[model samples]
Target: MKDFNLSYGHWDLYHKALKDEQRHDEKVQEAIKNNLAHLLSEESIIMTNGEGMARLPVRSMDEYKLRYGSNDSSQVGQGDGSSAVGDTIGKLPAQSQGKGEGAGDQPGVNYYEANVSLDDIEAHLFKDLELPFLEKKENGNEGEVEEFIYRDIRKSGVMGNLDKKRTLFSAMKRNTIKGTPGIYPITRDDLRFKTWEDVRKPESRAVVFALMDTSGSMGAFEKYIARSFFFWMKRFLETKYASVKIIYIAHHTQARVCDEEEFFSKGESGGTICSSVYEKALEMIEESYSPKLYNLYPVHFSDGDNLSSDNNKCVELVKKLTALSTLFSYGEINPYYRQSTLMKVYEQIKNEKNRFFIFKDKQDIYPALKHFFSVKEKATS
Candidate 1:
């Protein structure tokens, strides 16, 4: 009899290649996160109905590879009959340098485009944002719906719920009883299927208020930007809440409730009175959605075209809304560098409960979302 032990020295060296690959993947993810502000508003990404890949420009890590020098002896290259290995084949065309110089003195940046699917981008972007401030309050109208949960096994059931493990065991038992000791011939009595019990579960309740400025001052571009913000926010919210109730509100000189179709496409021509929408949102919150029953999120988007007379009223109403909300956000879509009467007033209230953003162009859309829904803590719960 003999007892022995084996050992493999320096076994960790074999895993170096895998470690390098993991590091490269981490770098790619970091680059995507850094460039997400611009990538979020890109037309290609926004228009990808539900499936597609997004090409993101990321700087490649400087990799060192062994190669021969330009004047090395080992050379075998053919192009224009005067080229050798590691030498320029011909005059390389100038890259974006407008035909002025023979060649730029500075070195080129090492950038490579990485193709990531929509799901990947979503995973990266949303990982940093969360809905932690959502607190479960008392007096909930939490309705329960019937759901089928598989639990038991039965002989007579649908094919979709057939239990293979149980059926095989039954077949084996029948075979042993018949003195065959095999499970080849499975009978009707040996077949087993899974059964489900109907039960009720409580669903989450939340309300989202999407307010937009439809005044004459808000052109097609401003409205489009607002719509884009809501579109992504809605998708993000749907994943968090089970029953999400969205209240679409469009306001010019007055505020009115409308359907989803009219909320994004409807256009109005009138003066700007931003306080009207704020007041209307506050009224709706009190009349229907109680803060104790539903988590409240009222997001408002305008061009900062609020009238001077209504700025005072807007600030007062905003203070009240922020107090009764799970997450409150206000966005100002100002394309041109114009003076904003409302933005100036709203910035003074340094209440950390509410979030405010000013977007000049499409590139600012994603950043605005990150700012509005960004949680201070690390955990989403």
Candidate 2:
């Protein structure tokens, strides 16, 4: 190969282009953030092509060619065939309408599509929401958890626990003082071992009870709204809590504990008895999650339809749960179910305005989440 001197000017241009691309990507991300609520809606989630993958639409600037004027001023098209300055010379093609058919040669507005994972989307969605009253509970016992944490060093310990370098130095010093220099001479007093103290750490535990009214009144759209809310709620809680346990309870006239897959997918038909799920949730919390040990969060999603006779019982259960839980949130999914007995019953309850929410459509999901995460103020009589 012939001797050649490489020019670094192209490298500088490449770096500048890379920085411009990065800035453009950030602008696209900001655009996505502005439409985050719409992107997280039920329609968007359903339209996603893959699991945990979402297509985000971003507005992008179209590439334009810059025209430069000549240094010498001259009017070339000022002949008799040319049109006047104010008159239109030629007509541009009309823009296509919404989802129009047929392929056109004309350049269109740039719309960039970015594929983002659900985890990334959740990070943006739950940026400001934080769990309140997160306090360390009782100290947990330190067992043989197999965690190698250097606690302390001592003079006596097991052979495995011996600090080899320290022990060798001590032995060398002792040998020098006694004038008995040997290659591997080590006395019992010259041995220094590493000691470990039991580290008692406070465990911050939290449990979330996701209760859904799977009665016949809750249509597919209503269930979708509830499931979307729960999906975001679970993602947000996982980010906030160190230890989070989610219990999915579905109920019609009776309630039963189920897995998350079943909770969102399964459909049941029966009379709406809102108290059954609340009672089951309370029982599970008392048995498994102690109020003193775990911060409890009981979230109920319903269509606001409940038996008139069971409304009082539901209210009582909610009152008890609110007293035990760190936060109690109730989300009514159906807009037409406004005159529901359950909603009326909850309206009679005191000091739950911040926690209770009404979600009419997919648009209401963001507001409902804000309501759930909003700080509660003390209520006066």
Candidate 3:
């Protein structure tokens, strides 16, 4: 069997195409329209250009398909068609059929896998859209090329306008008059065109703050799990978003912000109050990050060894933290003890899935990290 793998960008394009195929179904189309009315013309806000042209980003999968998918049988679409070809188009002979060899009591592999081309995907998303290609020159000036061009009729006069009928005759006469003029003819700067640039949107930035306890009770094994969890989270977050802010906080009796070196390297022996860790995180956000714009995520690790009286105050601080964050997640790595008072407080959160989490041992770290990012809450929807 052949193994297949695709990059993140490739997966994005694949899903975009899958979405296009599903849009053609009427039931799917209606459901999409009802749910995504904000993406439609009537419900969406239209931003107008300086030339008074109202523009909206392409949001309809069906519309994108018609303009750029397999159904688009235009000249431009045909230019970049798929290369996959089977010379024998008709049915195969019975002997040549390897169906029964692999078949059991159930039916065998009857479905044929159609290889879709990348051109087909690109066509569906970029059809009728003006794509600008920029080439930087040695002198620092940029040269531009447009995939499509149109000449203005009024400015070019009736004879030299974009009309196919009159343009040829006007061009012949104009070239003859200029080409023979005292060996000094027209320069290359005579062309006048109105070109628009393709607007590119900026990638969204997200920050994931990992706060871990280095208290003596955390143990070496628990620390290993916590560090491994942070590494995995960093890799996964980097793949998903363009920029990721990884803030590490190590707390023993007290908490302080630390860099990547001190995060997994330092060890301590003291009491724990989880609230101090959160307080530092809150301060970091207030000083630099804006809750409204940034995708704030906080993941904390501890052995649930915090003081009993601070549990209620810790819960209150978490509630305050949620208002200033996109999501708040807690990972309690209780190594020796069966359960702790701090774990009980976190487990009782109103939105337990979104704002809180609990883990018992080192084995739970991987699953806990996965669960933290995988929470699809009603608020996020």
Report the number of the highest-TM-score candidate.
1
- In order, how many clashes per candidate? 0, 0, 2
- Residue 293 in model 1: lDDT: 87
Candidate RMSDs in Å, in order, are 11.2, 11.8, 18.9
In order, the Cα lDDT scores of the candidates are 0.77, 0.73, 0.56
Residue lDDT tens for model 1, 1-381: 157755322222222344355555676688777777766766575555435556766565555798766663334446675666787654434443355557656577766676765665677777666564666567656645567999888889999988988898999888898898876798899889999999987765778899999999988788878887877777676655556789999999999999977886668989999889888988988899988888888889999988899999999988889888887788999878876989999899876677888889988878888788776653333
Candidate 3 local lDDT, residue 3: 75
What TM-scores do the predictions have?
A: 0.68, 0.66, 0.47
List the pairs of residues colliding in candidate 2. Answer: none
RMSD of 3: 18.9
Report how far off residue 371 is in candidate 3 (Å): 0.8
Error of 3 at 288 (Å): 0.9
Question: Across residues 9-61, which tens digit of lDDT does each residue of candidate 2 receive?
Answer: 22211233443555556765686678777767835454342155566665664
**lDDT for model 3:** 0.56
Using lDDT, rank the candidates from best to worst.
1, 2, 3
